[model samples]
Target: MREIKVQLYRGEDDNYVELWKTVEKIEGKHRYYGRYTYGNEGTWYSVCDPLGYCELNAPMADDVMFICCDENGNEAIRYSNADGNKLPKFETVIKREWNKAKEKLQHNTEDLTKNFWAECWNGDTTMKINQWLLSYKDPDLYPEKANDYDENWTGCWAEKEIGYEPIPDTEFEYLGHKYQFTKVKHKHEYCGIEWYEFVCTDSPYVMRDTPWVNDRAWIQSYMYLGNWFDDKTYGTMYDQRSAREKVVAALIKKFPMKNKWDKLLYVKKKTGNEFYNCDCCYEKSYSDMADVLINRNYHRKDVDYLCKFINKETEGIVFASNRGNKYTIRQTYPDIYDYDNCLI
Candidate 1:
């Protein structure tokens, strides 16, 4: 008997993995079942059978080619059946599914409005008048270093007054006197759904014009990805005395924001590894526009659906340099571009 395990992004589905009994039809295909790890990270799996043959269909973009391993975790066999067995062709099927899923993932009425607010608010701090704090750390330090304001308040104010310069108290001392070392600055922007025009509903005369509520119904300011908006202003300042230092920094800065905790009170999904800090303004100000770009589905078709929805709604605002949620199908899956087994 030939045993096979089918998986969707490494999922345990019998339909995807076809198995054929030794006495059963060998010319036709069969389905098998198994599982890989969960979450956005990568995963691996193995399968061992008394019988030696198992063939697989073409894998999707995110699907990694399986490698059968021995008990000691060494590579054993290629993830295919006999030498004569062949994989399925996915060019036509993948393209068809891609188009269909893309259309299906289009945001609903609520989603359209909510996603718009999230994108707008994530750009600048329009939630609270003109006050814009890069990240929560900036606002938290505001109260502590408020008394240390020594520069002339008349001018635009030095970087110190605006919470950009390093505070003496928060510094680490090294040589003679007080040495102020490097501090990680988490940069971000904030705004809200009200800034846009389409979200409004009621008549201009009767409805109240408040920043929080508009005709289009705003989506609250919920935190998205971390360091997605970092401006790289945390580097050494030439003017400061102790500006130079050899240090390692995470390409993606990680700063804990306050609003994230408050938002959790309203939305119960803020627990565990899912909680990402908000970048709106400086402090923790919960607005009515929040959402994430990540699609928590295992299927490549499903992921493509969510990406298409984003592409349509954002109107090209979704890029690493441009505004809104930044993402790439390539980053998540390299196999999607392969011609023979592509899943795009």
Candidate 2:
């Protein structure tokens, strides 16, 4: 079991910030069921049966903190203590936190136009290669291995593909920086020939931040820490417009009309639904057109991440229909059992 987490603030009554916040729709008359704690009450030691009855006879749940409403519903929980420590409505906290997540999700997409190249392999991403060479050789792991062919110590050491022949190591002075070159190959053949290819070592930021993609690259790969020995996902990074963006971009392209009247409202999905809306929810009415972002394409494993699909634009362009971000809304909700393209 994971350790129970508690958050203590100096001024306010201590709150169980780690508690799982849930939502309960209130009907005519409702019963309450769950475990809870009062002011300075350490944790959820008090249990209440259904029908809003706090018998206070149940034992303390030392392991976890929860407030679950049963199938019958009516699990309204209002916890307080002698010292006046009180928790707001269960879903209230849930909404507050959810809003922060929603805001981050909606705005997380960066301008994919920048070419993240390494002027020098000195930063966190690039120095790693320097460190690797330092371990094997005293001063520098020159492209000596890069110039020759040997499985043990070479730039593309781990790639044992039969056909690939290591080209001689070449370097030149460019703006007072040395850029090393190893065997470069096309990721995949295009139109029966290799057309577009970019170079970055096993890991991004090794020599330069590699091009997994900048809106055009597919789900390409890089080694873990630029080291071939480490286990890694095939694609370290990738890029393409989102399913919704693809839809909108395509609509603007296909049905091109000059004026406002000709502008087709192709999108059917707009934000503002209960599963994501916590405020309009529980309340009598909901916010009109709640523009909360539903997902942030992030690589959950490392900080450099994307929660979006690994499919290239050509592959995911089908979503360029009425998907309108709403498609991701359905697939990327936090609690979904099987989230499509969920990097988990």
Candidate 3:
């Protein structure tokens, strides 16, 4: 027999009251069923029914006091809100009771590993290695073994099958900053060939400030093992270059220089002359060609000369000579000609 503390409250009262009850083990299960109520004055009292007995399947009232406990009344499982307090949270108490009923009889790692692999594949190598290592030791006695086993089990497994060899640490500069090589992983892709994956320790400032680049961007800049050898001559040349040189070349190729004039040309071709004109003139134009050209950063002497040159080179290019309005060119013919058609 063991005593367990439970909290219960009356329907009309907001305060919870604590109760202690003794439970007896019968046929490997705790059994206790009794109904006790306080009098109208709400005074506490005790009732003992020595001959009364009930099965575990009996319906319990909403305010019944119960806690999850083993046969000896020791707390078998920790509840999220138990906190060793008299009044445990309502939801935590319910969860504790539910878990006590649905507890697993044994731990099965095979099923758990299969489920984990099915969901995420072997991408989570850390979890797979930890689970595999735990199977070799008694978790209860050697609880700290999992924390101490920090070997790269995945790399060891790959090395056995692929004959993969790790490269020593190397330092290189990228984008005006230095980075240090950390580790490598090689996987067998063909009968006699293996592909390598490199990991580098990137600077914190570079990782945070760079807009589109991440830590893995350095490795991805280089071609994959299979593709690296596709160009026979270039591959031979690449093999000859030092590691630092190869990394520098990959980084340079990844972010190629852009020609400012070429970018301007591309914008002009895509958006047409209106965009170029507006861009160069700051979107400000007059009604006359002379005034428009003058406002567009052309000198006073060169404005007339350029206007005349443009009028000869383009069709329907004529200057409006109206004094009431600003002088500008009419590139298209209107139904009525309201301005003097000056050749320039």
Candidate 4:
């Protein structure tokens, strides 16, 4: 069996530390495996065969210990301040940072929720004012009549004075386009009678006014006039404006333009991997799976879905696996069984 050993050495400048690895052969000769140079700036450059070299920035205490694993990735040894003193493990540093980030994210989410409701609904904000301006209730089709009416309620139940002239089976210019308005008869269940309503057949957009309550009501009225207004419907103005604001807020949260957590959250969501500290390994695994899917002629969307599924389903297994073990779909998922079978 192969054996590996790790050693820490002070750099030539004495300002940094070099972490070196050596693999022992059957003949007892040691070969260089990799090295990482850690400096005071909280960044390190890792150089290994095949994978080449890369820089990693991790927030770690200066006195933290570097835990070295065996060839099988078992914690076999640890290096502290060179005096055999107790120190925090490498994972401890990563876990602390992750926890801090999670707390910040939770606080930001709460703030965002509160701001959305306050600025969009409760306050006299632009969105709230716009909603108020757009709010409308359809003219009461059936007004209640009072037995004895006062001067204040004289016209409360009077028939509507304003009438809409029918411009039927003709084309009219609206928003720089000619649209045909057709006169259609609709039947109401309550009245058991038919009424004539005019509708624009080919228009730029659905008209919200006239015989319909809202855009949805106007669109559905073609099938049946009973759909002109639903009893459960919120006022058209409030519903439409509220819906727009909600969509805007959702989009902002999903893809934050300026926040630092935006990129982190996006990567986590896309890869479906929670171990952000292992992004390099996660990316390599994701690429390998993508290549396999591409070779099978799977669509891009399908490949993305399969990668997400594999990452999610194998998350626990990957976490429990040996640190150095390559977390591949074949090794983690049940469908692939083995490296030779690429069923997924």
Candidate 5:
């Protein structure tokens, strides 16, 4: 989670200043709303729920609080404690803290973009990755633009395949500083690519600060395999089916295969130059090639990690072997290996 420090303009409520000035309180709603208002204004101030505007059944607004001020000392709003011990509102501390948050978010976004691009080429799109991207683009960075984007975005349009709403802004008290946080959400296009939106809030931060992203770990696990072992080219005009074939062909092309039988050896080959065969040869079943990938010590290390198709039907890993046949449960099961291991 990222953090940002804000100053309290005179006339801003003590509650508002206190709320927008902490580290912990700023991380929770980091990916949601950028707007934060106290419960003193009634539940009507809450964009947290879908109940519209109305007085909430919460407590008084004197617990912990803070005020927001522009660089010119224009007080925008006040944040206050509804039920917790009041926290202190420090101008310098808030500013310093928030600066760190912004840096982390920016770093995280850069890392996420690289991973996202790689996964797109692999025919897999994890929602967690998309959600992380939304957080990295935290709405606070582009409040006006994010709000405008949300106004037109239709989140979760196709079941859960689409995007989610902004995280919603919130405030909380910690170590005498009340922290304010904004949540962010995003929308996805028909191409399955995601774009961001914001839902500003006035709540406390919750998530802790951490390294933006683990680029080394990501590169070691994903980049290494894609670049070296899998023999899979990226950004090509192919979906899952076509992608599998291309990978298999890539494997064949690496060998000295000459005939159908030799190609079968290439298909079933585990490793070494012996596995190399002429490229002109073909195999009767694509499964023959899959068997090679499945058996190899190198590919096996992370093959299942890359192949997300494991299920009761296609068995083993979801990778497309040979020509894409031999889909069954038995072959791919956790504790079995043989021709009958797969159902198909």
Candidate 6:
């Protein structure tokens, strides 16, 4: 443990030292364990990092406590001039400053939560939340570091302060549909697994709204392979899946394998794999058996059902699984696109 010192100042009218911190260890970390600042005379000092969520001009106001260190950071006298200052107990001042910072952080979090819900719902989502913190004038919130704020910070704040990512109302034209996705900033978006809005190019205005879907196939077919919205902004990453793969996933999700023809069902009925062979294919588990069946062309009937769904919904979207469920997009690369084994 390195020797360090703490100081309390009025930090209101002027930067006058009010008290010296005689004790150490408030909550297990250094008193100034957040950020650093460069001084006018060339020096480095600690600043509360989370205090960035609070205003520096707060009444009674910001950082009355500061961390002071020397060039070699040698042990320093705890209370050099306490008798002259007639200061309160070291904990008293520390708690006072600490409590204020906590209350301010809580207040900011509540404020952020209120503002986000108000704009997200009410049918007027502009999806321009990157500038949500910019409306309030400075000296109130991060006035000193306002220029450094942007979508990156906004996203980070939402996760930390707001506790959820804001899902913007995004739309796109692909796979013969004009789709849109909207949600309360704190909710999760989808990929046939999460949640989103999907509609064809000619969808009626009345049919344009976020829907609660139970099946991945229904939503994944309409979502971006990754997504138009930056997942990083929400403290999340969008999945990378091919459109054809998504279609196949949907088909497989829709497939009925209750019959004996499916290897899983065959194993269930026989209840023994000692010397069993799914046409010279042997597996001890259902997952392994399924992969063997699909990759080895044991799913000929499955292809028919899958390709039918793609053709009817996407119109000429030839689904191919030659490359392990991920097929080529015919419109973009026809020469390499092959559906001969698709059986549809």
Winning model by TM-score = 5
Whose lDDT is higher: candidate 3's or candidate 5's? 5
* TM-score rank order: 5, 2, 6, 1, 4, 3
Cα displacement (Å) at residue 171, model 4: 8.6
Q: Write the per-residue lDDT of candidate 5 for residues 259-330, one digit (tens) a residue.
A: 545433221222344344321122334435644444422122234332443233123233333333333332
209-285: candidate 3 lDDT, tens digit per residue: 33453322122222111111111111111110122232323322332324312100000112344523321111111
Candidate number that wins on TM-score, 4 or 5: 5
lDDT, each prediction? 0.25, 0.27, 0.29, 0.32, 0.32, 0.29
Backbone atom clashes (below 3 Å) for every candidate: 24, 12, 6, 0, 81, 4
Residue 41, candidate 6: Cα error in Å is 35
lDDT of 1 by residue, 113-179 (tens): 4434633644222221111122222323344533332122111122211012222232221111122
Per-residue CA lDDT of model 6 for 1-344, tens digit only, reads 23445533212212321222323667775343221111211122333332333112211213233234322333322222211222333323333433433332211112344445745542111232322222221222344533442332333222311121222333332212343322212222211112122112112222222344332112222211111233223211111112224333554554434543432111122224634422121222233433322342212244345445643543322222223323323223334312232311
Q: How do all models score by TM-score?
A: 0.16, 0.17, 0.14, 0.15, 0.21, 0.16
Per-residue CA lDDT of model 4 for 29-88, tens digit only, reads: 533322233322323233444123322234234354445544444455554433343323
* 217 Cα displacement, candidate 5 (Å): 31
Higher TM-score: candidate 1 or 3?
1
Model 4 scores a TM of 0.15
Worst 10 residues of 2 by lDDT: 281-290
Which stretches of model 6 miss by more than 4 angstroms?
1-281, 296-344
Residue 268 displacement (Å), model 6: 16
Give the true-structure RMSD of model 3: 26.4
Global local distance difference test of model 2: 0.27
